[model samples]
Target: MEAKKNPRVDIYRLKNVFFNFGLMISISVVFAVFQYKTYENATVLDLGSLNKTTNEIIEIPPTTQPPPPPPKIQLPKIIEVANEELILEDLDLKLDIEMNEDTKIEQVTFEEDLETEPPEEEADKIFMIVEQDAAPVGGIKAFYAYVGDQLTDNYPTAAARMNIEGVVYIQFVVEKDGSITQVQAVKGIGGGCDELAIEVVKNSPKWNPAKQRGRAVRSRKVIPIRFILRQK
Candidate 1:
């Protein structure tokens, strides 16, 4: 038995053409997916006004103040008075004449005693060098012993801390009455040493007054005080 078919309406004849068309459409879709570009919605800020600069010229008004008033003047008062006549008397001024070589002029003596009593000698005059130099009440060694005893406890803290060692020269006045006066440091190495030396000398016992021409006199004396730090 032979099967009969229509040749013009055959579907199997276009199979290759339909396959190629489907392949080309798949390739175009893949290319379009890879090359796709998307736009984003962004807002831009306007900063042109912030970047612009303007210079302004301002005017300041001057202050207006009134001047101060002048000082008030005072006028003197006038008074009325009665007129009076003045009477003046004549005076006689005659000096007696007495002038001769042997007329014996009496000596004029002052009732208030104008002799001026020789200026009552200056009491505070101090002598630099005297016949006898002033000495401490005890001998020099004993005086130094007392000073050493006092200074053992009176060492300056600053001087001790820094190990400061030096001699302080002090000048003082010995009065006529065996009293010490005007004790001062002539030269010193600082650090509270000068002041401490002055204090110790001021508290020392009175010294034997100096003598000049067999009379007790005020005199100046200079002494050196050594500050030595001992090892602990």
Candidate 2:
């Protein structure tokens, strides 16, 4: 016979042990009992409507409106005519058609006040393009030569530094008395050339006055002068 181990030891030595089966069965039974007790004794709310509702009744008074007035009816207009028997036939209806001799309308006359005003004297006018252009003592070429000479004397220092070169056209008026007036530059190239050109023209000698219709007249003129820089 094999030697027998201790009965307590043999009892505890299970070959295929179900270690947690007892604990699991106990837990499952407790959980099922808890669920059943909860189902049996739970405080369930009916939540069913009691139908206890209060209705608010509002009484609206009838509108106190005034009745509309009746529509207006227009009656037709009637004209009365004179009766045949009541009409007057022999009654004397005379209209005096006579002129009064005392009503006299004399011929009316309006005497106007006569005013005599002295006439205004005619103004002497300056012409833009005269019938005959004004000239220098010589001619246009001579005039340009004179202007060139003047500009050469007073050549602008700035123009020389920048080597500026262009033509400067100047405008002025020749008076009827052979005098130059209102000199100004019409176009310019920069660098003090404009002023220099204007000064040269202003200092020029008087030109022969222009003629219009064979008579001496004041005239306006524009002349161009060249400003050239020569390289040595």
Candidate 3:
């Protein structure tokens, strides 16, 4: 049989509405719980205690200095001196000479002094070029022979070992007395050849002094000495 159902008691028709209302209420509760916040109390500072600070003052002491010393005083000194006496003497002069027209005066003579020493002679000067040049007692050839003889016996061992061969130029001064002086080697090859040449020339015999205007003079002479190494 068909029966009339009560709209209020038929809960099936409102089931959807009940379910949607419950869903909305649950979402609102969940949102409220997530958005909740709690606050803590703030800390307070006491500025009244720090406002009563006192200012401190520092004091400096004064220093006392000693006074400077007084200046020194000096007294003047007095000296006594004796007075000296001066004596005066009288002088007498004679003026009683007489002159006549017949008086004859002897002739006055002024002779030169013969005892005075003559002016000193100047030192002998050396000449580079003279009218006649100095020569050895014998001849130039003879002089060279003498030199060779002197050097042959005492050949420098250094020169021979090194085979040094060259001419050594020797210079010497010939005095006014024809004696050889100031013998020196002007140019030479090394290896003791220069000293040997000088020694040989120094011992040479006297030469004829050079003449300049027929007067003997000191002169300079240069000669070349040959040094050769001989093979055995």
The C-alpha lDDT values of all candidates are 0.87, 0.82, 0.87
Error of 2 at 200 (Å): 1.0
User: What are the RMSD figures for all models against the true structure?
Assistant: 15.2, 12.4, 14.8
TM-score-better candidate, 1 vs 2: 1
Candidate 2 structure quality by residue, lDDT tens digits, 1-232: 8997777777566644666777788899999988884336679888998788898999999999898998888888898988767687989987875669877777998886567444432346778877888998788788788887877777888999999999988898998888889999999897999998888888787789988767778888888879987665
**Residue 6, model 2, lDDT:** 79
Clashes of each: 0, 0, 0
Candidate order by TM-score, decreasing, is 1, 3, 2
User: TM-score, each model?
Assistant: 0.48, 0.46, 0.48
- How well is each residue in 58-143 modelled by candidate 1, as lDDT tens digits? 89899888888888888888887789778656867567887788898789986797765544325798999788988999889888
For residues 74-164, could you state the per-residue lDDT of candidate 3 as single tens digits? 7677777788787556746557757799878889999989898655333467788899999999889999899888778888998898888
TM match of model 3 to true structure: 0.48
